[model samples]
Target: MNCEVYKGSRKEGAYLFVADSKSLENLPAALTEQLGDLEFVISFDLATRTSLASADPAEVMASIKTGGFYLQMPPGKDLETC
Candidate 1:
């Protein structure tokens, strides 16, 4: 599926992937707080990705499928790695 990627202002190397810009409005409150400001990075076809630098494609798809968004935390942080 097509998706947009946003980087969290409060964390380095952290990324938030959503179905579209509209999805940002539907993110959970706690998640928004944790992520702080968001900066649009890039938009791409997620359905064609086989691998990512810091996250598993299948897991990211699962989150996006269930939550309408995916939080890709850095290699080591407070939450689970995306």
Candidate 2:
């Protein structure tokens, strides 16, 4: 699978993981483990605006300072064209 990491900005911060159907199931656990050391961390479905809306401000800020976050894209997404 191909993966792309999106670093957030102060005005609109988030980690967006886009994957094909085959890789979607594993995203949550993988993201959790990968982000384990971060503070005030949480994950939610990308399809819902409310989910992203609930992100903790403090956590987002911390993540921004700590090199931001990563988005795991499915294979064939071709991030270079995105």
Q: Over the stretch 1-82, how does candidate 2's per-residue lDDT look in tens digits?
A: 2223332232123344332223333445645444333222344343333233444444434443443343433344423322
- Best model per lDDT: 1
Candidate 2 lDDT trough over 10 residues, lowest sum: 3-12
TM-score for candidate 1, residues paired by index: 0.86
Put down candidate 1 lDDT per residue, 15-37, tens digits, no spaces: 89998999999998888877789
lDDT of model 2, residue 43: 42
Off by over 4 Å in 2: 1-14, 17-52, 70-82
Q: Per-residue lDDT for 37 in model 2?
A: 32
* TM-scores of the models, in the order given: 0.86, 0.23
TM-score quality measure for candidate 2? 0.23
**What lDDT score belongs to each candidate, Candidate 1 first?**
0.84, 0.37
